[model samples]
Target: MQNDAFMHVRKMFPDLSSHRHRDMKVSVATEIKWVVFYRATITTRDGNYQHTIGQRKTLSFKDAKIINLQYCMGVCTRQLPCQNSGYTDPRECSECRCPEGYGGTFCENMAESTIPDCGGELNATSTYQTLQMEGDFQAPSGSSCAWRITVSLEGGYRSFYRTLLGRSM
Candidate 1:
């Protein structure tokens, strides 16, 4: 695997001088399905650093069936305006990929929830506060809930929230 990877990199960067193996991660999806992730940092003769990632999927070990051997170079930059803890979409460079609870082009609005009265804005004070939510135990599959918490920055003061405990039924 190392020799094959080196040869592949040499083909792409012909002037590759040095390379270092960074990390390898393995995830098991099922008894016969597995995913392997590889990361490496390479340097060329021109002193340019490149970060590379490779993903390999194995379907069966008995038959040695491997598929979707994908590789990517460089990091995805946040070129688009992603608001409210969102991030730029690597597949669509011009768009933002919002979080689970955020929507809109730039993730500025709250995402719609399947449960009624599930999401809303709440104000936070300097003192500790509690926000509790209860729902039917037998909710349908794919039901979702969300909330947006905000705090006013008056008098040059900042506020933060800490979760003491969280549980899902």
Candidate 2:
């Protein structure tokens, strides 16, 4: 309800700045006011899309609740890394703006790994209790060979695989 509330809102939405006047009252509600103000500013553009949360004048207490105060208040001034290579406009919220290619609450998966070359081999070695390796495929014998790459952990009990297509002669 103090300056901290407004600070929390600003922390959540870095792209938005309070457009309120200098003499405006500050309280817990003030954060909602600024959210409404900036939510209008950014979304009302000629071609900008309105956010679902911005469609209403007043949100239910649950909707307006500051769900993650710890995270928001703790890193108000920090530019946190996006989970999955999401784009973060410096002027916008500290949260990552995930691209279409990435899909997750935090945009964790952004790019697909490039398949290894036909003749390339990926080998991983470890001196620990078990061994681990990840890379491209090894050299091929002929034009008509299919390669299946498997990745195993230290004990070799957990394994995942991908099938690589064969090259045409």
Candidate 3:
């Protein structure tokens, strides 16, 4: 039986490399009645292809005449997860290759960003003004948080300071 299966495979793909070829699964489809289905997995430079051959009548592996055969091709044959939006068509692996701006096993992750000077300072002042800054801030140690506004005196006098308590600043 092994020799017969090997002969069939050799006859189908005479040049199939031993290192590249994976395995052959030969099974009898009893529910189909009198039909034997065998699948051969062959690896190539692009991907893997499953060649399924269905033989009829004789139970002997050597005498079973090939009645139906089909080839299912591509990387998706391995059945990997490919629900992500950024993934393109299958290339040479189980999962489709990601585009330029996408990544991950299924290309579900967006690529890192590259922006210049994302943060800068914007300051304004008037003759008489109320300074207001409001946002979420992380503190180093102080139990109480305060907003401080300092004003320099007209001459060499000391500076004027005011503190507003609570979360707002």
Candidate 4:
């Protein structure tokens, strides 16, 4: 990961010495599934002069996918509301950076799923509730369902539990 970090930085500053990473500070900002977000700060020296540079980038080693590598390196100045566990996407200021199961321009809707009639919003209450789903599990490669569960009770806590039972055909 450190090597990939230097390679990414070198893309912007080709003249930067590879050895300069000794003065670099790389930290994990967030991790979601297979994606890992990183924030790197480096201190550079030119004779008696010194300078510092920082960038926020993401890397997915399993598939070699890097998010926000070409954009959103700096702070976003746009004011946009992102809903349902979503934040402003640096790559596209007008869109929200949604979590794994959410999507939309502002993350106000459930993500599209391959399975028909499988995604929507649900409301939970104090009583026990159940959500059951049955689909063809043999070829479930790209099938998915996203549901947003919300509770309106104030000053109360909620707990959720899920169980999956599958058998080979």
Winning candidate number (lDDT): 4
lDDT of each: 0.37, 0.31, 0.28, 0.39
Order of candidates by TM-score, top first? Answer: 4, 1, 3, 2
Where is the poorest 10-residue window by lDDT in model 2? 12-21
Tens-digit per-residue lDDT, 1-169, candidate 3: 2112111112222111222223422111221111113333443343211112343444432122121111223434464554332333445445554433334677554433222211111122234333232333322222222211222325522211111112222
Please give the TM-score that candidate 1 achieves against the real structure: 0.37
Model 2 lDDT tens row, 86-146: 4343345555554323334455642232333221222222322211223333323222211
Give the local distance difference test score of model 4: 0.39
Model 2 vs. true fold: TM: 0.18
How much is 157 displaced in model 3, in angstroms?
55
Put down candidate 4 lDDT per residue, 84-126, tens digits, no spaces. Answer: 5466666577777755445688866556665465446555544
Superposed model 2: Cα runs more than 4 Å off? 1-76, 109-169
Better of 2 and 4 by TM-score: 4
TM-score of each: 0.37, 0.18, 0.20, 0.39
Total clashing pairs for each candidate: 0, 10, 1, 0
lDDT of 1 at 160: 21
Tens digits of per-residue lDDT, candidate 1, 1-169, equal: 1111111111121111122212311111210111012233444453221212232463221112111112211235445666754556656667666534457888777666655654455555545554444432332445554544444444542212111111233
Q: Score candidate 3 by TM-score against the native.
A: 0.20
